[model samples]
Target: MLGFFFALPNALPADTRAKMPGMFQRTINLGLDLQGGAHMLLEVDLTSVLEQALENEKETIRQEFREADRLRTETIRVDSENDAVIVRLRDAADSDRAFALLRDLSKPVDPTSISQDKTTRVEKLSEKDFRVTITEANIADIQKRTIAQSMNVLRRRIDPQGTTEMTIAPEGDDRILLQIPGAKNVDDIKSVINKTANLSFNMVRKESNNEAAMELARRPGSLSKVPPGAAFYPEEQGGGLIVERRTKITGECLKTSSEGLHPEGNYPIVNFTFNIRCARLFGDLTQKNIGQRFAVVLDGVIITAPRINGAITGGSGFIEGSFTLESARELSLLLNAGALPAKLVIVEERTVGPGLGQDSINAGKIASMIGLAGVGLFMWLSYGLRFGTIANIALTTNIILIAGALSLMGSTLTLPGIAGIILTIGMAVDANVLIFERIREEAHLGRPPVNAIETGYRRSLAPILDANITTLIAAVTLYFVGSGPVRGFAVTLAIGIVMSVFTAVVVARLITATWLRRKRPKTLPI
Candidate 1:
């Protein structure tokens, strides 16, 4: 009686064969392939590689200058546009000596080729001034490795998706090529990776005096932005810029974040909660600086610079940007997704028509109906009414539980996933047959109804659990090792196994127990 109540939910309504909403509700998730989205292959810029290598060489050049102590005559500068380092003599008398130092400094660098240009000019007092310009050759050395690092960063940045099936790796020297399926909006993804969201906080410096500007530019701690030339424009909201050292707490530490109206009641805001560490730091910062403005900077721009009116030790804070409701929600998703490993560059894109998605849904539904009908009919014909009906009940439970499990796990169920569910229906009935046959044998031996039922189940328990346990082990292994669609199959199989056991052993036993208690029939049916 109890089992019937439980089992009834699994059975389909007689006329329509549709599931009850409250009994089993499921939403199908579409795969990238079936849904028709963009596939991407992105490569990182390799020129940044050359610049970094040159910067390293600059440090070496500085050391050599310090060692010689003759730099009252020479200056070293990296060209803003090109990846070249220039060493020039300031005093005409030190030209030859400075050239000697330049050679020594550049000796460690494996320059492929070297060339020099000489020029002479008459000084103000009519003295001849001569200078030598040399160009080093090892410009192309770092290209391959730089691209490799960029590919790695891209891989790291994209890891938040937790997609093992998608490939993002290096191709060859100076190129990174790989594919991610089902991702629409290639431009959006490209924007994420291409935008170097490097942020920093630096104290504002006075720009009044030339000497001060020079001194500030020379400071080891201060980073200077180049003045606008023909190619670039001046900073709109200007002051100082250095890479913002991230807060001890980042968006990653957040547990849950949502968009809402600000408590002060003016504009849209994003409310976020962080773990213990973030909360402690945020609370302290808010408490101590009750009136000072702390900038809420993202990517680079100072989006919000609200005053710290009070402490916020609770690990919750509002990101009140110039965000509309939609943008606020989108930002919330990005923060919730955690930070990307590097940046993402979308090298591919496409969109699927609604017609195609609808076609897939129809095909999947028809296939499911056919598979269910075939399985149900076969069970009835093979086992006869009483036994077959119980097996069908168990099969029905298997489907319900699979749907419920999918919902709980937050997995999207695509067409391949639906195929897995249909497969599970056939597989779920095997255990019930094993137990039923064991009971039939006991009843045929002329044992009393109660003794036969108990004995049959007792004997069947070990084999049934062992069989399902072994299958479960395989299912779990596949779930971890296999990619997208295979994983769906594994999940359905594993869930069906557990649910099959419950419905077959527990539900069937309850029905049998009720019958034995009511009628106490002596003759066996099967």
Candidate 2:
């Protein structure tokens, strides 16, 4: 009864549902495949991820060598082509020590999982030259981690407002599948997800000993091949700045950001606060570097580079670029959402219109009706009216229960999900058929009507339970191994199976029991 009441809203028009009470207003969300929406397949740049991982590995080697033996390295550079790190020792005699440090940095590919697959394979090329090759297993692990992280970041970036049912899930080894149900603005959707918004505060090189930065800046190249101690940040407006390679503040440290007007210029700005730990570190960085400049970098582009006039002990600061009101709010939103680990390149894009979606919905309805009617008619013909009526009642209740559960759980319903429901309608009668067959056998054996009915339900209970349990296991496995609409189908099927068990075994039994006590028939219907 409660299920029927909750499922009522779905039968009404949009205007009628709006007028209902808050609790009754809920409805199952239509997924991207069932509604007009944009579908985008994005591929993660594994090259950038590998380069970043190798750079991090190089730094780890440098730190371990310094702390373990105080051994100085002449050069430690990432070989992107080979996905390896080569380290040159200042003293040839420290080769063994350097090798040991690199070896210590090596660990299992997955510390929590397998112990056999190593992350790094360390080898000494010469007396003073050593190369640490990142194993393929390690790269594969990194790809998984990067993809997972990017999915999380993309989820936040894509739907901060929570306006629609959006699907953001990993597609393959290096791809993300994004589906925005009922999304109209395809360009806007693309723009938001494409923005990496990786923010970092890099200290500007005012006076540096390394002429590599000067030489690199004069060359005017990308940030990847800058000097060892400096990073080249190109401004969004024009030109570029050479800043310290080491980042003092990053987007990860940001606690929150809000749109605000600048104090002097009255222009829109993004006011940001660092987390507790980064706040202290940021304050110290600002205090010690007074009168120096730092570039506010976003996605390898300089947003602003302001000079530190005095000690900023407060953890809060504002970014003032040529931002309008909307852009400021967007920047703040992006900062709060965090950064994507690797760039997402669009591999494919598609859009489905509402006309096609309505056609799908109509077709699904037709198929479901045909299936339900055929099954109910067959049951009515095979068994007597009394037995078939009870079975049909249970089947109807099963569907109501599915709808109510879907509505309450807020699960998105896709075309595949509708198929699951139709499949479930067919399965709902399995218990009844078993019970009817058992009752017929008992009646043929000369048992009384009430005795045969009781014996039928009792003897058929084991088979019914076994069948449902195995089907439930299959549904669970499908859910675990699948994503997107596939999972939707699994969820709908699983829910339907549960409801089918309830209606068939419980609801149908209760109705039979009521009839038995009232009519007290001398013979069984089956």
Q: Point to the candidate with the largest TM-score.
A: 2
TM, every model: 0.55, 0.91
Residues 347-452 of candidate 1 have per-residue lDDT tens digits of 5445555467668768877887787788878877876776677677767766666666665454656556767677777777778778878888998888877788
For candidate 2, the 10 contiguous residues with the lowest summed lDDT are 207-216
| Model 2 agreement with the true structure over 1-526: per-residue lDDT tens digits | 8888788888889999999998888898998878889999999998888888888787777667667646888988888777789999899988887787788788988878846899999989999998899898988889999999888887787787765678888886889999989989999978887888889998988633256555555566544556565667667777667788676589999998999998998889999998999999888998999999988998888899888998777889999888999999999988888988888889899999988888989999999999999999989999979999999999999999999999878889999999999999999999889998898899999999888988998999999999999999999999999998889999999999999988988899999999999999888776
Q: Which stretches of model 2 miss by more than 4 angstroms?
A: 19-23, 59-70, 114-118, 208-219, 222-227, 236-239, 309-313
Can you give the lDDT of residue 299 in candidate 2? 83
lDDT of each: 0.58, 0.87
Give me the runs in candidate 1 sitting further than 4 Å from their true place.
1-196, 205-234, 237-341, 348-354
Model 1 score (lDDT): 0.58
Clashes within 3 Å, all models in order: 14, 0
